[model samples]
Target chain A: MSILFDIAITAFLIISGVFGLVGSYGLIKLPDPMSRLHAPTKATTLGVGGVLIASMLHAIAVEGQVSLHELLITLFLLITAPITANFIAKAHLHRHVERDQLPDAAPDDCWAVHDIEPFQAGAEPSTETTK
Target chain B: MIEYAIYFAFGCFSLGLLMNLWQIVFASGVGDRVLALDTMVINMIALLVLFGLMAGTEMFFEAAMIIAMLGFVSTVAYARFMLRGNIIE
Candidate 1:
């Protein structure tokens, strides 16, 4: 039983560490900003998640105690990571990407980031659309 | 075995943090820099957890959690600033 627990914990640590390294490597190695954005958001989140899981397992199997705080961190990270990525993508689109560079959105609509006045109070929505 | 694994994990994540630093320094755009900073925050959290494991203490979990929350908020603030030229409105 002890050996099995050791194996599991070791595997989790190594795997998560590899993932974390790969994610960070991708940040520097990927050629473009948007492609670079893809790296840390998905890969690093998984990496942290793996570490948290390993920590939980170590607390339970080895230390003979329950530790649920890791769960809270994992849940919070999972919820927030995508939102962070989306905001970054939107910022990139707004500042760096050209309207013509993106593939078309639905025929009459444009990308939300490109919309001229999405939140203006009581203003009429534009009838014209990007083509 | 577990000891060796912990050491390896520490090396990996520390190296990862260095790579994030390189990205932050050399990145061509604001978004990339923000992303690197966010990644660095995550690497720091992983290091904190590993330290907790090594020391056999739960004290670091709260610190890790707080860092996670703060990192997310700061990343969003950076992105918002980039998007609209301001953070909160």
Candidate 2:
């Protein structure tokens, strides 16, 4: 039983480590700010979340007491990552992208960042090409 | 064995921190730097949690939670400043 618990913790730690490395590599290798945004938001969120879970498990195993505090960190991270990504994306669109490159929005709609929504409802997704 | 796993996680997170630092330094736009900073804070929180486990301590969990809040606030402020040239306005 103890062996199985150890295995679970180890597995989660390894998985978290791998995702964290991939996220970092993606941040460095990906081209353009918009493309790079995908790396840290998605991968790091998973990586950190995994690590936090492993921590919770370890505490329970070692202390024999349910350690629920780690869950608060995980919850806080889960809530904030997407908001951070959205704000950073909006900032990127407002300051760096060209007008024509941005998609058209409804005539009356106004984006708070730059008065322009960068994505159109029907616009094709940007090609995934690593640089 | 668990100790070894914790050490491995430490190395991975350290590498991530370095990458974020590089991005913050070489980024072409303010948004990239802001995002990198945000990611760095997350990595730090993960590292703190792992360290807490390795040391068999509970104090780090509170620290990690506080850092999470600080990181989010800073990320929002940076993004807002970039977008409007004024965070409060």
Candidate 3:
């Protein structure tokens, strides 16, 4: 029984931490705000969610107890991540400075398409890529 | 079998930390910092949950909740800053 518990908890810890790392990587590696947005949305939320669920499972399976705090947090994260990411993306576009030159505006800065082409304007975006 | 899973998780965490840390250090602009911070929060929530599991108690779950709430507020603040040029605005 002790061995089983040890195995489960260790796996849960490692998995939880890894997902966080991958999402952060995406935050760093992607070229632009739009592209980088996908990394954390897809990886960290689900990855962290998975780890947390595993922990919950262990809590119940090992001790026959139930907890709502983690579950509620997971639920909150799932709902907020996309909405917040979208808000940031929209705000970014509105204030992005080069909105006038973007080739893929979706009738508004907030809804612009991902295929924005700057060079097609015969001039690179005057606003340097932020990094 | 579980140890292998642990190895996998460790490898993933290290790789993620490397990426986020790289971005935090090398990237310019406030947006980069905001995004990295968001990612860090996501990692933290998971960490807290697993820690709760490690202790075999529900204590870590509350920490996870607090972390999640912080993540939401921070993102909103960042978005507000981007939009109105100030979080309070």
Candidate 4:
């Protein structure tokens, strides 16, 4: 279509592609699983958003109609990524990560997955509510 | 020019996909592999959308959406299994 439209689409595509590559690189290169979690959840989400927006713009320019499906996919992805990250992090905390490595929580505020009783504490707050 | 840019972007995504696959194969822990798989799924979505743009077809968009849904579901399932040692329980 128009040069400006072409440039915009190209820009979106390239920027997204770069982010995708960087996220994947971080996923592979990061030393810790916790650190790796940061890569795809944030960067890759934005990358896919960019590509989807570019697709929407292209569809609108070429077919003269709005493409709403991409928006749905974007919404679904945005909603799910964090949930998935949370579950995975919880799983890691339960099965792999050391308890000492975790941020100190009040004894009553224990994570639900941990299944430990709210430990009695004299000094620290009882944040361990899960057990 | 736009066509060339699309090709370059595709190349970048492909490289990223390959990297993710490598990590998935060699990752030390299940969680690491799962995380890599999640990243791979995202990269795949981006690649599929780029393909749809290049080909001027919307069909790949449907595939991308389906993959996005399935990937998240599977990740959640895996995480639950890891946490509780089972999916449903």
lDDT of each: 0.90, 0.85, 0.68, 0.83
Model 2: per-residue Cα lDDT over B1-89, one tens digit each: 88899899999999999999999898787787888898899899989989888888898988989999999999999987777666663
TM-score of 2: 0.89
C-alpha lDDT of residue A117 in model 1:
45
Judged by whole-model lDDT over C-alpha atoms, candidate 3 comes out at: 0.68
Off by over 4 Å in 3: A1-19, A102-131, B1-11
Number of the top DockQ candidate:
1
Where model 4 places Cα greater than 4 Å from the true spot, the runs are: A107-109, A116-131
Q: How would the docking of model 2 be graded?
A: medium
Whichever of 2 and 3 has more lDDT, that candidate is 2
On lDDT, the candidate that comes out on top is: 1
Clashing pairs in 2: none
Error of 4 at A91 (Å): 1.1
TM-score of each: 0.91, 0.89, 0.74, 0.88
lDDT by residue for model 2 (A1-131), tens: 78887999999999998899899889989988878999988999899988988987887788788888978888888898889999889888888777667667656343455553244455664676322
lDDT (10s digit) by residue, model 3, range B1-89:
54455456656765775677777778766666677777777766665555555456676777778778888898889876666555541
Residues B1-89 of candidate 4 have per-residue lDDT tens digits of 66877887789889989999999899999998888888888888888888888888888878998999899988988887777665663
Stretches of candidate 2 off by over 4 Å are A107-112, A116-131
Chain B TM-scores per candidate, in order, are 0.98, 0.97, 0.78, 0.94
Please give the DockQ score of every candidate, comma-separated.
0.71, 0.63, 0.48, 0.59
Better of 3 and 4 by lDDT: 4
Q: Ranking by DockQ, best first?
A: 1, 2, 4, 3
